[model samples]
Target chain A: MDLPRLEAILSRYEGESWDLIPVLQDIQDAYSYLPKDELQVVSERLNVPMTQIYSVATFFKMFSLLPKGKHQIKVCLGTTCHLRGGGRVVESLSHRLGVEVGYTTKDMQFSLETVGCLGSCAQAPVMMVDDKYFGRSTVDKVPKILKLYK
Target chain B: MVWKISDETAYDTLGEEVHLTINGVTIRAPQDQSLLVTARQNGFEIPTLCYHRDLPSEGHCRLCVVEIGEHPRTQIVNSCTYPTQAGLVVQTHSETVLQARRMVLELLLARTPKAKLIQEMAAAHGVYESRFKTDDPEELCILCGLCVRTCREVVGVSAISMKGRTPDKQVATPFMEKSSACIGCGSCAFVCPNNVIPYTEKEGIRTIWGRDFELQPCNVCGNYIAPKYQLEHWAKITGDPVENFFVCKDCR
Candidate 1:
């Protein structure tokens, strides 16, 4: 969060704009999300405008501007998964998490998101909590699944 | 395998070590190795599409997903790019992982109804048919990144890349036009198990390439018969104005 640390990081990538990816990655790695202060530091050190930094961060889904919860729930809304009730799964999760998609809980417990696909079609209606899969899920199982995290 | 002196010198300069646990199994990997590589090396099968050892891991295909222990709720991540940390707990095939994978396959199947690999994979998962309105059956490619990787690594030509993002993402020649660097190498076709893009040489007209060719079935037994585009392209390339060549071997 300090300007000096960010300046040190940016100095490592001197004369290389392409290194911006790794620099941003390092920042995200240190802090789960890109803080505004860090973004400002990166902008100042890299000589890139704050708007441009924000644009690049927002362009890729991987870079999150806000702090993500310790647990991130990504529901696959791909065509196959959607047909098999991907929407229902997200709805159930949103209702249970008390937050809409792309929002983290106040306690920093969970973040709900809808991803395009996770590439496993055998189990439709899939929801990934943290990094594990819960397949063939229904609204009924949402409570039990959420309880496991607690 | 003879080791060169230079190779030995390079190996001696190695630094740093990391230990990670995948599915409760502890393994030591070099600092540079990704979690996916470690898991695969240990015989844990993580499904992947955009990942190839020879090419840079694009991490577009979310197939090789794993749940890292640091995250409390299951988060589907592209394991191909996620680095392995010391004390990392990875769950490769949990129920959450399986469900997410199934949905991805289903969506791909619906997008490209004619893709044999998608259909076959779906069937293997007990998915008889997609519930969504099927896309035009002419499509074949699953946009799995094989063609893109082949072009970049083996072909040494970055002619094709992932054009769109997420559900809309697909491998295409630059600007979605026929690439001059293609060299008609057919490497993309060869690596594509789905037979999505077929190369055809017509007799006179410009050769039609990279489009999904219809494989007509045998009239007698109804078995998938011949590559319609191949015959058409052959006729056009050879300057033979022939229509009867469309029939399959049995029918002919």
Candidate 2:
């Protein structure tokens, strides 16, 4: 919906066809999701077909076409994390949020997803919100940590 | 344009010839032309499921695999993607090649158990049953990608796409919707090797990918020329008047 902001992002990429991921990433960052019309605009500007753009957007887990929440919570489910009650932590978080994994909250405040690994096994049962990683995560600490975001 | 690939490129002999031995028989063909072309030119038939001369060679099916180099250092390669070169020793019907092709056919047979062509091909390869699991017993698509390549490369519309990875991959319109970009050309259905893509034509309407298109009739002969949408697309591409395409090419 922010036309000027979309134009600014397009200018940053110089509309190169091969920079599709970074362009989509920047657009996702700017709008929380790749808008359909904006993607059409990208298709026209870069001379790349819409199907290809859609394929690339859907192929990468990082890019989302649907509207995502303002805050994204990632639970690391690596071997160490899983052994250290990561499953319980995610279940409790999914319960409290009343949102399924890979879905945004109805209020659009939080989205929950699980990652294969956060590469922070020392911080087993790790849950991350935005850029901040919460180590030694527990079911009891979910609500408290979520409260800090909004 | 239908069945035109056989005339255009069944055997490519235009470029400088390169000699290669297949099964101890010397075969000559244009340098850098695929080994499949050279082999077929020399009366050696290599079984293929995903090859169409008009489309880009993807080597997707691996049905035309053959053993290359010599014994003890031979490597199995898809002849559809491997180019012929001088003195390159190849074996089109070696034991290793037969085994590899049979295994590929067996896997394909399991994947598309209902496809009659696959059944016939498997029967020819001496594989009556498959050892692998069949996820969908009625699945006819072998994921050879001929339809996908035709849609993207030749049509230039890219209305359909090959989405997802193994076991989940499928050729589908964007978001599985009736795509606005399809142009109703029917190229996808035309290029499908296993004849899997659902397409129907009746009366004056042609249907595919969940959309209907009116087939244009030649003004002079009353013979159907093409889909109205396809003629419109051709007009758009050639920058000519839409009425110019209403007549069939022969009538014109």
Candidate 3:
């Protein structure tokens, strides 16, 4: 991340701390994760502390302070979803992925996470593979879904 | 045809423009238009909540996040507030964006278990359960701000504004009391996507020009289970008016 670009982005959100979220979001959008060097630059340029930056980065579920795999798998665990077997889907993914939630596979092929809900409960037990929605998922479908991703 | 022009001078003022690409589709828009609006206008579908055209964009719902460009990489940007800029690229359906949107929907579903839209959207997203604690508390308002925005912007009555902050924010009349400014037009209820408002009426009472009847709860369950009109409406829609189906809370 360029220091000048970071400063220019930060300049647009002068005097507003809440803008920090969006700014960080923009940074993450550019890098896939908040690069440590950029975080330092943002800390110095925005007059925000590095620890504060890290805290804010980790505070929201959206921000990723570390590198991620090429593919990100998000399983929906909303209530109607949960009742409809969202948990089983996540468990199956976790077992198959062999990495706990928030961790990338050693091969860097995938990262798994459980998400709140996607507001499509009628299609409960949903998992998002890359950009597509795989609804009404069952534990049995995990292998097929993972195979498609690979 | 002699049409007298008004004395007011009309001049076109062009503001700064930004260019961005969504899912490989190039677009140009005024810098102020939210990415969501721009994308939708250009035929890119991005799902959103707490985002009604009538309401001020309150990015609390976090459902419209999208991935943008290749640089200081942030995977998800709230499309509702993100400004487009020259040379910027956006992916409305990126892997990251889809995941984030699903997570947001899941969280909302955990809080509002009975909202039909939430259910439908969750189902569409393939959510079956909230991994978090299930607060299956029955609620209708997904807190999308459409009602509040419609009341203020369309109705010209700022009777209700979102109260509180994240994790506790909600649309409510001031102090959570009956609003004096509320014309009782039921626009809030009418426009609400979640159907969270509970309309109270006594037997033989009339409300908003419609006949009112006591909504009976299930005799066994005691859930304010059935609205009389809802039952009648369902019967009309389904053409099955079996009175026995209208069980009380206890029977249900």
Among these predicted structures, which one has the highest DockQ? Answer: 2
Q: Provide DockQ values for all models, in the order shown.
A: 0.02, 0.53, 0.01
Per-residue C-alpha lDDT of model 3 across residues B186-230, encoded as one tens digit per residue? 566778776676554555232432324456455466555455655
Question: Could you tell me the lDDT of residue A140 within candidate 3?
Answer: 94
- List the candidate numbers ranked by lDDT, top first: 2, 3, 1
- Native RMSD of candidate 3 (Å): 21.6
Candidate 2 lDDT at A41 equals: 87
Error of 2 at B59 (Å): 2.7
Question: By the lDDT metric, which is better: model 1 or model 3?
Answer: 3
DockQ, ranked from best to worst? 2, 1, 3
Among all candidates shown, the one with the greatest lDDT: 2
- Writing each residue's lDDT as its tens digit, candidate 2 over B5-112 gives 432364453467778798898867788788887888788999999888777688989989989998899999999898888899999999989999899999998999
Question: Over the stretch A40-108, how does candidate 3's per-residue lDDT look in tens digits?
Answer: 667666655443455566557778867778888999988888898998888888999899988999998
Rank by TM-score (best first): 2, 1, 3
Q: Which stretches of candidate 2 lie over 4 Å from their true place?
A: A76-90, A120-127, A133-150, B1-19, B249-252
Give the alpha carbon lDDT tens digit for every residue of A10-104 in model 1: 77787355666788988776677888777656755665544345546765887787899988889999988999999998898898778999999
True contacts kept of 1: 0.00
Interface RMSD after interface superposition, model 2: 1.4
**Residue A74, model 1: Cα distance from true site in angstroms:** 32
lDDT of 2 at B210: 95
